[model samples]
Target: MPQTSKIFYQLKPLLQYVPSIEPPEKRVPLQDKLFWTLGCLLVFLVASQTGLYGIRIGDKTPDPWYWFRAVLASNRGTLMELGISPVVTSSLVMQLLIGSRLLHVDYSNKEDSALYTSAQKLCAIVITVGEALAYVVSGKMF
Candidate 1:
């Protein structure tokens, strides 16, 4: 086995007993823009769909609001500057670490399982809250 596959093989059985974590079921789309619009709203919390498209490209004119609006539209760019991006980037790093046995969890032990569960919850919370704050404070939504 390749080193990566071998590492995953060792951890595979442990993950089986770690308990499945599922996101809450969301409302099914009804072939209408309503749900899609709502979903976008949840993500952006913006005024309207049209308003979102207007801010896409940075304005050329020397308007003060142009920079402000661009910063809002480029949410990831703004978040990158605010030091929140690493928390997100580190989550991916942690996944690679877990897969590579750099952060091994001995799932055979109940305590270890609980620790893994808590870590997962903590990661989820941080990502969710961080994204929400980024959307709201950066004015990216609307």
Candidate 2:
């Protein structure tokens, strides 16, 4: 196992578990799936509009890349300021690393596969905090 993979396994224990939907007992109707998808989208949009608690007192600067926040699902000073940046960025890097063969992990192995997934989540979380701090430190956000 490479250093990165080992770190993921080690960190997994300390990370909070996000509850997700388990496998369904049977296939859902297409209409049901569509409604669920739409509902989730609505929720996401609403959340994005919501402001962050206790983060209302910040000097708003012109974001050079304000467009990315929407694409990344991040809202300024909101609960989702971290948005999906961490997950998307981490996944992208991991895919590239895996594709370039820089980090060797046998996808065929279950443990290795789990390690990769866990690593992605860990990397995202770390990135969320790092980016948040960077923004505040640089006076881009409060």
Candidate 3:
């Protein structure tokens, strides 16, 4: 079977649970489905191309020399210029910390409007500083 049909078959159980008047398979027209799929793929390809261009050449179209120079001059960029390994490690560390509740804040029994606002500010500050330092230390800030 085709990959798409296999996926539809896999979702058969969930589709059966829905109390719809028409069956799910026949609900959408073949033309509409094909158009939607192709439209999404075309958009994705365009977006990916633009993003890749931006990364490789930055904003300037003439040359990528300036981008490399800028990366070397900045500390954060220097880390990224080195490699992608540090960035991934730092992201993993932060994810683990948040998941383990090491960065959890208590808002229980505190409904004051001003207090909530202050808490939000505090959380933003912590997250910003934490992420920045994480990148710097892990050698991937750029």
40 Cα displacement, candidate 1 (Å): 21
Pairs with backbone N, CA or C atoms under 3 Å apart (clashes), candidate 2: none
Q: Rank the candidates by TM-score, best first.
A: 2, 1, 3
lDDT of 1 by residue, 1-142 (tens): 3343344445555545545546548865577558778786666533322233335424344543445444434332232222334345446765777887767766786656555555554555567578668866988543
- What's model 2's overall lDDT? 0.74
Name the candidate that leads on lDDT: 2
Clashing pairs in 1: 46-141, 46-142
- Each candidate structure's TM-score, on Cα atoms with residue i matched to residue i, is 0.35, 0.69, 0.25
Which has the better TM-score: candidate 1, or candidate 3? 1
Report every candidate's CA lDDT: 0.52, 0.74, 0.43
Misplaced by over 4 Å in model 1 are 1-94
Write the candidate numbers in order of decreasing lDDT: 2, 1, 3
- Tell me how candidate 1 scores on lDDT: 0.52
Question: Could you give the C-alpha RMSD of every candidate to the true structure, in order shown?
Answer: 10.9, 3.7, 17.9
